[model samples]
Every structure is written in C-alpha cells, then in structure tokens.
Target: MQIDSTNICERLCNKSIRDISWLLNIPRSTVSGIITKWKQLGTTATQSPSGRPRHMTERGQRMLKRTVRRSRQLSAESIAKDLQTPCGLQNSTTTVRRELHGMGSHGREAASKLYITKCNALDAMV
Candidate 1:
C-alpha cells in the first residue's frame, strides 16, 4: 500500500473516517473507500470482527413475494414449501418470514406479479 494509504489506514483503525479526514486533511469518502477495499481484500484495516451473512437476494425477494401473492392465505411454512419446487429456495419458515419482513411485505398484501427492473434496484441502492 502507498504511504499515504497506510497512514490513512492507521488513522482509520483508531478513529472514524470523519475524524481522520478532518485531522489528516483528506476526504472522508476517500478514507472510507480505502478501508472498504482493504477489508474486501482480506486485509482488515477497520471493521467488526464477524457477523451473519445476508440470506436473501433480490431475485429471492421477488420470488417470495410472488409465492405469497399466489397463495394469499398460506402460512410461512407452506410458502417455503411452494418456493422449494419453483425456485429452489429452501429456508426455515422463520428465515422466510424474516426475509419477507425485511422486504417490507410481511403479511400485508396479496402475492402479485412484482418485477425488479435494474434501474429501479439501482435507484433504490444508491
């Protein structure tokens, strides 16, 4: 790593990027990006030690919603069953429920056709 990057990483290890940016006279985003890259490359400049991985994907979200929409009154277990054959998504009913809750569609609306366009997802993410 560059000397400047090393200094920035040292600062980031002890301080938040906002504080390091102010002290070292660098952009906060630059410090943040460098730290993220280090972590991605398995060099831990700064981060929590570990956490559970994310369970569902965008496709999984749409599939779960469509499954629910198709069988409006099915329990989470039944929904998980329906999903197994169609999309090969096997999770505990609890897992399915949590993913549905995260997607903002738990027990609220009838399962209907919902499509995820690339533009829409990009807009949501960024």
Candidate 2:
C-alpha cells in the first residue's frame, strides 16, 4: 500500500494541481501545499515539531521507573516527593502521573480495594 517515489514522480511531475488532486482523491489545497513544500524544502517529509522539551531526563525517568517498580501502591504525590528529595528533579504529582502514563503504567486500584463486597462479606461473617 506504499506509494513509490519514482511512480509518483513519473505520474505527478508534469500534472497540474487540479489533476493531481483529482487523481489522488485529495483537496487541491493539500496538493498545492505539498508541491510548495517539495519545491521549498526539497522533500515531502514532515519537519521536527517546535515546542518546549520534556522535563524528565533519562536518569530521572529511570529513577521514576525504579521507584514505581519498587512500590506499585505508591501515589503520584509520594513519587513526586521521592523524586524531589534525593534527586533535584522538582516535578509535580501531575508530571509524575504523566510520566507513568507515558511508560504504559496507568492508574489502577489494587484488587483488594476493588472488591469492597468481598471485604463487607468477610466483616459480616465476623
């Protein structure tokens, strides 16, 4: 399903913007933009995004991971505190939560906490 550069060059090099738009089933504006970018940048590739960089370094991320792995039940506030004490990374709880999310670790209640009915039943039996 990939479009070959040589095939595109052969088919679309001489075609008008309207013709390219019709052939590609895309908007004329998009075609024009692509052509303009190609002419100016000499490539149709995406450029690097402009924005503020991440607050966490590789060492900080590793420390976060280690902290999380060491104590799965720890809260974001606690993790942030832990990171700030020994390490000089003054990240907020929200930032720790975000880093945890990026690492594929989502916020989840423990199994024992989730089964309130079971705990209630045991208490009633006692």
Candidate 3:
C-alpha cells in the first residue's frame, strides 16, 4: 500500500509519532523514520540505492553486442580474450557468458549435418 505524503502531512503534521503510528496502523519506528526522512530530504520518496557500479558501460555493451552479432559461434573464452585489446573490455569468460545470457543470446552447440542419401548426389548431379 502506497502512503500519500500529503494526506499524512495534513492529518498528522502536529501529532506525536505514537498518534501517527496508531492512526496509520504502522509501527512507531516506521512513522518516526518517515518523519526523519521528510525533515532531512523534504520528501518521502525513496532514493536510489548506493552500491558498486556496473563493470560494463553503454559503449562496452554496444561493442559486445556488435562482436556477438558478428560471430555467434564464438566461445566465451575467445570473446573474453578478444576483449583484452585496448579497444575492448578486459573481462573474464564468466563475465562474457553472463553478459551474453543477459542479452538473451544463449550459447548453443552446433548441430551435426544430416546423413546424405543416394538421391542427394543424384539431385546434385542433375
């Protein structure tokens, strides 16, 4: 359930955290946290999470896509090795495989050719 900030402000602006908690049916700590966040940020919206950045940039992803499109049969290890060039990303085979899977291009074994019949050579001769 989404909380309407304006509704909460208008209803509980002058109220205690206990009152707000009782009125909203949420925990006192939650109400207090929300009030603290609003006071500091002037908004109740959640901020983007802080964490490690992605290894691949947009340019890197585009380059990877082009490389994959150019040769779908390339192994992930080969791709990783190619990516070690100055113009490409230096990544592990696992990273290449993960990126490929993320892009919806799964690795597949090449299918074998079907056995040829006598008529196949006859048709070719014709």
How many clashes does the backbone of model 2 have? 0
* Per-residue accuracy of model 1 over 1-126 as CA lDDT, tens digit each: 463476556765787778777777878888787777766775635566688876776788888888777876889888888778877877789989898787777676667975989998999999
Q: Give each model a TM-score.
A: 0.46, 0.56, 0.58
How many residue pairs clash (N, CA or C atoms closer than 3 angstroms) in each of the candidate models, in the order given?
A: 1, 0, 0
The global Cα lDDT (0 to 1) of model 1 is: 0.76
For every candidate structure, what is the RMSD over all alpha carbons to the true structure, in angstroms?
14.3, 5.8, 6.3
Minimal lDDT window, size 10, model 1? 1-10
Ranking by lDDT: 2, 3, 1
Please report, as a residue range, the 10-residue window in candidate 3 with the lowest summed lDDT: 1-10
Per-residue lDDT of candidate 2, residues 83-105 (tens digit): 99897999999899999999999
Top candidate (lDDT): 2
At residue 121, what lDDT does model 3 achieve?
77
Q: After superposition, how far is residue 87 of candidate 3 from its true place, in Å?
A: 3.0
